[model samples]
Target: MLVVLVHLLFYSCVLSKVYKLQLTHKAKHIHQHKHHKRQNSASLINAQDFDFYVNVTVGNGQVFSLIVDTGSSDMFVRGPGCVSNSGDNSCECDNMLPNPTACVLNTFDSSLSNLSQTAYVQYGSANVNFNIFSGPVLFDGFQITNFPFGSAYQISGLGNSGDGILGLGFNSISRVAWATGKDASIFDALGLTGRQQIFGTYLSNFDFQHFVNDVVGGEITIGGIDNTKFTGPITYVPLISESYWKFNISTLTFSFGGSQPLYLGSSGGGNAISDTGTGQIYLDNSLADRVNSFLGGVYSNVYGSYVVDCKWQNSKIPMIFTLYGVKYSLSSSSYIIPYNGVCLSGISRNGADGHTAFSNFGQVWGRSYYTIYDKFNGRIGFAKAV
Candidate 1:
């Protein structure tokens, strides 16, 4: 079957300013009967921002574990004669990672699979030569054909990243489709019942209390929303554009305990995109500098991010992001990543290597909200995960 598992990384990105909620009256929860009973969903495996991937069985029963990325729209894999980048722990499968067999990955064999012609793909840090395989892609109960993908022969800067990358992005920018002059993306090839083109993501991190993955778990849900993964009403916002899962920013806020939510005021008219592939949350320099100013951190050229006192991890609550009129948030625990006895802010200034221009909400943002991709209606939903 064509299996597509989008594994979001507990990658070393996504950050927030520290906030000490006022110890006035304690926070209380009022139960309400607002539920989105969409039942189609899947599970995800996240290693504390380290990596998120899935077992995808492609053409001719070949299964590959690919990183499910929503940032760019293209797919590629490493096959015969593939090489790895030096110093990348991914290929070596470091013991510190959640998956002890992280390096025990898979690769495609172009010579074995049915093929059409040779093709080349140039993407972020990847340069590959592959064959246009003519076969079916299967997953769950869904089968996709007509659309084709590359079974790479010679690859570089890719296999080292993961088994491969399964791009869950729009077709307008698909490199394989543009090169082959055919619909090569699985997103465009799947023949779903009715016009239901919804994709949902429930991403989680390694909670120390529950070291063997959280009890709630995480995964990418296709078809419709998974009511069991989240609770309450989903905050929906119209997609401002069709290229990416892009949306407009209403306001970014934080507060001192229970004081009135203080607005960042920097992202007033700015826009942001939800990227599953990237681990860090990026914003304009003014906004990042402003957030870091409040968090009281200094930039570290060595790490290409701000280094904060680890103590700030305890004095924080969720950082609020207002889109349209709905509010979504990410807690400081997810952003204030602990490393070598110090914490690094996942929220950083854009323009760094491998970052988008506008504000980008990567896995850090998704860790807080159960993100839903309403492809048919051109909207995105953020349901606060229970």
Candidate 2:
């Protein structure tokens, strides 16, 4: 026919120049992923609750319920087959309390130390015990020496709130897998006073309505994060590759009136974890019951509570998140949870057997909100809330 119509017009001009170079490289990769999620949402970190403190060396008084953890560091107490609520028994020895005469005997005499006195144990049910104590260890006045800790060696009663767990996580070399020995941390003796660095924490002996005041100490400042007890401008998130402490949340979508009931890892794959001890915000019990039946199924199991019912008014509520590619538009009060002012609804699917025993790939963006794990200058920030 005329050389087959000039070989079909030269293969339709080479498939329209490879479809305009794949639509200009996918619109410049969605404008460089919205300019790296607005430059990592400006390194967020609005941390406070009186900065933080919980350095209690060996079961102090009769009160306990501490939990300011960054994922595990060291500072322990809970010995004596713990299982209390005042009925079961075993936890009220205070290592044999007497009367603040500078209460001593925080023993661990594994032969003074060549190394090795292990016996660790931890993870929520809280039956503490795991040691290594060297000490001048005073905290509020800032004193530390070979203090690798965790003790409550089986005391179960403080089961609910807190009593010990202030590791301000970041893998400081060793003695943390719940920690048990080889002593040395407090930023490893701040390099014998040349002052290497100090700043690590998770303060909250109680307040956010958890209420257990005398404020029971809470802190973790190794290098930074004490900006005069938090006012604003401190949003940072970066830490998930020193091999592992944990925090890789690059995706975990969830929407309501605007549609996407639940999406995870998006088109490419999966990853979602923030876990500040995961009080709530775990999806995938069938997308958390289809987003609580698309928001009309109201909810409230009490573990940090979530109610729902703003009526989905203007609709378009979003929850899009993408870490490495950087995108976070989590509106709707960053996933709503108000109370007397009445906006209650924070999305929950009752942790289907705890996300089927830790994700085979389902969903979990837990800790409702308040996820800012800053590392500083090098880069790691994730902001949310006013």
Candidate 3:
């Protein structure tokens, strides 16, 4: 972990700061954009599986909405002179921000601030290349000075998720850094450590009736955990890796119609990461095939996902994930999503690397349960969200 401590004396006093911000889940249908051209054609388009974002004000009170992602650790926004792959100069910003018109119309000027460095990051199907600059950042009412962030000059495949991203993962994964080779995340730069290194997420389930009216749901607390968002005892699991919120799982099984439970192989056990950036659960191909076979799900070349029988939408089948001796069950209603009158499995095949990734779509597990990411101790906690 790279830690950069810049001491600034204001009236001969040092500052220690903590902050809390509410996150809202923006659930809406996907719209075609210039950036979408860079993403995979098979990417989930009809599903409501984007990330949650919080309002943040960067330098000079220029506010921007940023996705609060635990899977990545870096912060960036489009800057002046940004152009699309097709050489289009107009970068259409998402309307979710505080002032979309102002944000889209204006850009960050590096001439007025200290140029710290330059960076490039690869996220989802997007590549973000930007200039690093240090300035004041405000979250809620807390303010941090000389905070390093990226001013994107080039980007792709961001979709309409959010204006930018607020990476809450480990600082080691941060792409913004000084030329001297030291890297520090936004949290580290703000000096949030020790017991204050805790944060919680409460994501809301998708409601079909009032789609446009209910886009704002869920909450994210920084610097401390929100006890009110969860119930029952929190089950804390140690992190297996520092890169992402990687953790261990004992077993995975599924039960259907009161039938015998089928045990999926444990080959990819203890090697899973909880990611808020992605929309669905990605398991190793072998495990994914087994689950799909049992669910009568077939790979659709049109959607690039497994489509199961729509009748199973109300089935009693439950997918269970046992972690740290605690069994978390995801009801059929939670794992199966309805798209275009067809039912699609929330579970997807992992990459060739064979690592399992539990994402926000699978976070139907979190919908019924609250999740906590403890950066101080490098652990994750879960409790009933009710």
Candidate 4:
């Protein structure tokens, strides 16, 4: 009996030691994961996704659409369908053209090709095709030199989602640069010597009305922020990580009146991905219905636009996107665009598998947040305001 008792005591001691070690190891892993996640969230925003809209004139006094994007510098348009300045020969755009309204080059330069049917370019997803070309860039009453540009595959609905997309993100985040060998972007051409190249852009009031007209051009000042257009003080956030360009978010809390502030994705390693190319905010689908319920379903999504009841009124829901030990609120107006004073613009879902740009994806933050891609300033800032 004495021998058995001693043996039992030894085994118990050993088991306790093993359990302690296991607990210590798990704690360390949890700490490491949280630290790494925070770093990723901060770096993601540093990636640039800015683009500008423009108007181009074709034959018979017809004006078409164009956009300035650094991601894709090369510009191309449909050779057969679109109107041109004056020639009927095989479509071509050259520097020496008399009118200078040259179409983007359609030649298959091996150096610039990415995919066989489509040119592989980077935007929302990895390893995809982007249509690139060159055309005249007109901004703020100034006709800058004709530069390279590009577009994306068109979705059938969405009320004519413009002719194409103009990428303005930095080369680090651009797919256009990888597809085409042309490294120099419009920002580089407009460089001001010592300062980082800058472009200033302003959207015309008409664009909000959804009509095709000459772009009353905006300023795209590279290397600096356009103080005239943005009135509020800029909030600067650093890009600390790489590859994904994500940063560490301390917390993301949302509140509605007296209810306890709901912590979003605190568990399961949840972090918000900011994308300008995406026109809405995307969250985990599981959280979509919960968030929408909190917002009172402000906009009924139809054809990708919000149709709200003009007399609808609900408690102002506040979403605080916290990063790098700081917090910024998603303004009420930004989250909910009122058709008049009561009706909301819309709320849509966003995701790759079953989500969309309309879901709590791009428009969530894109509509309200004044995203400052100060690549030149070396920091990205988000501020909430009217």
Candidate 5:
């Protein structure tokens, strides 16, 4: 019995010294934001079925669509001199979305504001590359000013989602900081804003058969939860790792039609990343193979993902994740994706070596619940999404 323990030791545990920036809001103002407006709410646009994007207003009325990512902690946009990793042939973006002006590189203008220091990030596994410059980032409202962000003029393999990524994770282990040699700001700026130290992600369900780009998807609320998005009250759990919004998932079981739950054979628990950027629920190689095989799925070398029978969509099967002793369940509807005349399994292998159970509770899990990344108290909150 080769039981692999899901462990993600790739993320550094060292906490860096950050120059905290505090945005002081008055007592009455804070109360109103919490009780009245729910504070800093933005609608999410689903980029097909891949991921979600939020349109952000940047320098001098330049509206750029940025992926609302909770897994990473740096914000950058499509800027000038952008090109594909292969060459200058492709810009690695969508085919001209109507609302967002720049569907390609050469969008960001460094001359519009003060720009100094270079930042670059490379996702070796995903084949996405970015070259960035740190500068003052301006928002449309809520007045999150003087936030240091990345202006990526050179990029490749950005995919068809958005112009850039708006990372919402903690800055303690920011890759942008490692790239630019300067403090990465945004989450830090929101933390010191004297309001709620939490932000919520609500990715909506769309028409599976007729999915397309530029559709109203969901919302991202900063400061507090929108009581309307979820049902009942929220259940909060302490974060096991703050660097990447990680928590320990006790077990994963396959249950169907009120039958006895079948364990997918992951033991000693596993650390799962609650990532908005990731679209599929990732499990260890052994565990994923086990789960997919049981679900009548097969691995495709061409796609590099597991493909299950399209009939599995109506199988009434639910994959349950026991997180901190709480069972959070996802129905087949949320886990089975219909793509290009075939159904793609929302679960995939983590691409890590044996004996490690570094799993990920991707956006499919988010579809089952409204997730709150609570920074102040260092915890994650979950509520059944309505």
Candidate 6:
């Protein structure tokens, strides 16, 4: 079963001042869902891990959990009768285990909302047709009024894990089309208006000994970076592109037992993008093959991943990535995931679409560093996480 969980991120226009906001961490879980309701009773596998989300109150008092995405630029929630409105009247909602409450949260009421407009978005095989409505969105003690969001009337390919997405990216890629013009992202609506235009993320390591369901230790700061979560001076890298949090990785290498390091070739030295929504790292097929060869990995048709010897899980292999002259290292424990008594390489082959994406630095690189996305400065900062 090969499950590809799609996650997103975003970039916003520049802002004026700097402000600070505290963030809360949302834990991840693996769940099974039926692929087709009537046709096939087989399960659709989800390869990606659950993303980080935050709780926010919408409308009068409708509280829902939404994924904090940096690769996308629209926010929406599942509305009542969404499945019926999905063009294909025969389509039914996937049976989500534990009955995700986030999926069934109060749907946006256009009549009750201050403003309403039509909108649409496509995410990870899910096409959402919705209505954009303005309401007061409350996070912590801060409140923003007339905040634009989507009430999904038609949706497909979305998992039941999260109610919707909170896009932190630029408005250029926003799918929300207002009656008059484009819709501003929540970050742009808040951060560009005399408030701080920066946010930080820290995804904690998952400890097996103290494993707990629905519990995560990571956090995201809205207005500013958290000084307490990181140590040492932060290294800033200029953004190569504002499409995503895109940057350049100068070098990539893998070293085993302190021997000579093998240079990992990334097309054009790798045009990398950082995303909090995606799990695992996706490399070009050539690069992926190189990594698998170095780790003595064998392709598993069952999992569609390169399975390595379980002994490698405890080995001292290290993968290093250099960005902006700064080197970040990932140990064996960071790049290898233990599954079914075997260890699987975290690096996977990118699609053949010809777009080179060093995907999902989270869990591995993110767990080791505190990352800050500075939209105002058009740069990304990293520091050793505490």
lDDT of each: 0.56, 0.34, 0.57, 0.34, 0.58, 0.56
Q: How many backbone clashes does candidate 3 have?
A: 0
lDDT of 3 by residue, 67-186 (tens): 556677777776777666774322456664332423431444442364657888776446778777667766656566666777777776565455666676776777765332434565
Which segments of model 1 are wrong by more than 4 Å?
A: 1-40, 83-131, 140-147, 152-159, 193-195, 213-217, 250-269, 353-356
By summed lDDT, which 10 consecutive residues of candidate 5 come out lowest?
26-35
Q: On residues 218-272, what C-alpha lDDT tens digit does candidate 4 reach at each position?
A: 2333434334445566666564432222333336555554466666544214434
lDDT assessment of candidate 3: 0.57
Model 1 lDDT per residue over 55-146, tens place = 45565566555556776666655454444456422233222322322232233434234446776655434466665555555443334554
Q: Pick the candidate with the highest TM-score.
A: 5
Q: If both were scored by TM-score, which would come out higher, candidate 4 or candidate 5?
A: 5
Q: lDDT by residue for model 5 over 276-350, one digit each (tens)?
A: 776677777777777676578887764556778899888877877555456777888888876656676777766
Which run of 10 residues does model 1 get worst, by summed lDDT?
26-35
Ordered list by lDDT, greatest first: 5, 3, 6, 1, 2, 4
Would you give me the overall lDDT of model 2? 0.34
**How close is every model to the real structure, measured as TM-score?**
0.74, 0.30, 0.78, 0.55, 0.79, 0.76
- Of 5 and 6, the candidate ahead on TM-score is 5
Q: Which whole-number lDDT from 0 to 100 does residue 96 have in model 4?
A: 20
Once fitted onto the true fold, the runs of candidate 5 whose alpha carbons sit more than 4 angstroms away are: 1-38, 87-90, 96-98, 104-115, 127-139, 178-183, 191-195, 209-214, 251-269, 352-357
**In model 1, what is the error at residue 106, expressed in angstroms?**
9.4
Instruction: Give the per-residue Cα lDDT of candidate 1 at 378.
Output: 85
**For all the candidates, what are their Cα RMSDs to the real structure?**
10.6, 22.6, 8.9, 21.1, 10.5, 8.9
Q: For candidate 4, give the lDDT.
A: 0.34
